[model samples]
Target: MNRNIKFDNLRGFSMILIVMGHFIGTTHFTQTYFDFAYTLIYLFDLPLLIFISGYFSKDNPESSIKAFRTIFIPYLIFNTFWIIFIYLTKGYVPADMYLVPGFGLWYLLSLYLWRAFLPTATKIKHIFVISFILAMLIGTVNIDPNFLSISRTLCYFPIFLFGFYFKNLEEKFTIKRSYALLILIPLLIGATLLYLPFNSTILILKYAYASLHMGNLKGMVLRLLFILISMIIIILLNNIMPSKKTFLTKIGKNSMSVYILQFYFVFTIPDIMNYLGFNYVFNSTFLCIFYVIIATALVCFILSRDKVNKIMDILIIRVTKILMKKTTP
Candidate 1:
């Protein structure tokens, strides 16, 4: 597949935001500013990532299997790592260790689910429309949080399909950077302020659940608005950013590594900080933001190395080959 620099840059940018979001979420916060930043990041970061993954997904006989290995295998491996990390660190077994995905690992499971289902789902005409309505309706269902990975998968399925089918939409036009900024700046600010009233619920919607306090109708309306707003923001982001070789572009190319490996740091850093007596210094909102930025860069640098890629290839590629052989007979 030919690489699209614009999408690569977008992916890289989204990954950083995701890392930052996780970092912010893990902090023990009583600060309003930290909550605000975390909410803003949560609003669109993973949705954008899911959409991009769909955009890059190819439809082929082996595509599902390939995507499964590429994503799900790593998820299993890393989730196991997380389980061990938790047991060693906290000295207790979390009941949902195997049943639910560990922090930051659910995306891989969701991605695999989307890819596995998309081939058949995309065959129906007006699928995106149909799937979106289903996504909206899904918000009304009372489901267990243990079912979250699958619930969120079904909810975001429309956006994923939209990305695949709306290929031409990406290049339909480009907005001037100045104009894009002029529009996006005020739009984001206005949306943030308007969304603040429901900020508490808006944060949980990212988990693909209806707001506990809001009615189903209101929840559906707000969820749809989030979908639209997220799409617009991602469009403007892709249009306005420089689509050339840069650090983010480099990070984007190695996104898989960063995505898979960054969770360890995000989950462990607080304890590490506390152990080192730097918790007081690093717990501030500004310092947490700085920590997220530096940590993202460090993760990208460390995981993008050839040695790490080779190790990943061994796990994903080698296991894939083995599975194929076992199934051949």
Candidate 2:
């Protein structure tokens, strides 16, 4: 398959925001600037990630099995590690956290499901409508938390479908970089203005919440709004970013390793810094900027290493070969 550098750039952009957003979320201080920054990052991070995932999705048995090996195996392995770490450190085991996806591991599970569902989903006419209806209907019900990951899987199915269709959409309506700035300026300002009243509500909706006491209809309405807004941002981002190889492109190329492994530092580093009595160091917004830069660089450096990628490749290959054998004639 030909490499789509724009998609890689998009993933690189989203992955950085994901890491930064996680760091900011776990930090102790809260500022209006931080809140606004966090909201902007939150708005498109997952949607962009999922959209790119769908854009690259291939429908075939080999690709399906590869997705299982690459995403699901690592998800299970890392989740087990997370559970053990929590038990050893916190002195209590949240069994549910392991059995279900805790932290950001849900995306990996969701990606596997989306790829698996694609064959059947794409064959139907009006899939966009069907998927949206299913997502909205699913939003109305209170799914068990143990099954929350699957709820998100269902909730964002439409976005995935849209990404799949974006392949067609891009051919007809390519937004040039010259128009990107013009379009983005108004959208960002409007989104910011709207965010004042709806910040927390938007956050709740972004997570595909079953209910936030807004009742089912309103909750569904908010989610739909979020979906629309996220798509617009995704489009703008695709237009704005350079479609060439760059530092981020390298990071984006190895985004899976960074995505799966970065949480280690995201969750733990603050504690480590605090334990080292570096609270004063992390207090300033300037310092936080520095931290974000360093943290992102460190994550990219570690995950992009040859040894680490090789190890991951070995495990993914081993698992896929076994599973493929079982299913093959």
Give the backbone clash total of model 2.
0
On the 0 to 100 scale, the lDDT of residue 9 in model 1 is 81
* lDDT per residue as tens, model 1, 1-329: 77788787888888888877777667767487776776677667877788799888877767787777777777777788888888898897778775788876777888988887777776778887887787788778777644447667767787787678657676674678888888888777766766766645454444334436667888778778877787777777767878677777766777887788888888787788889998875657677667767876677678766678678777877766765555564
- Cα miss at 325, model 2 (Å)? 3.3
Q: Whole-model Cα lDDT per candidate?
A: 0.74, 0.76
What's the true lDDT of residue 88 in model 2?
78
List clashing residue pairs in candidate 2. Answer: none
Worst 10 residues of 2 by lDDT: 201-210
| lDDT per residue (tens digit) for residues 1-329 in model 2 | 77788788888888888888888777755767777777777777888889999988887666666777777777777787778878877898775875588578888888988987788777889888988787777666666634548677877787888788888788565678879779987786677556555645444333444445566777677777777888888888778889778878866777887787788888888889989988875689888877877887788778766577678778777766765555547
Error of 2 at 136 (Å): 2.4
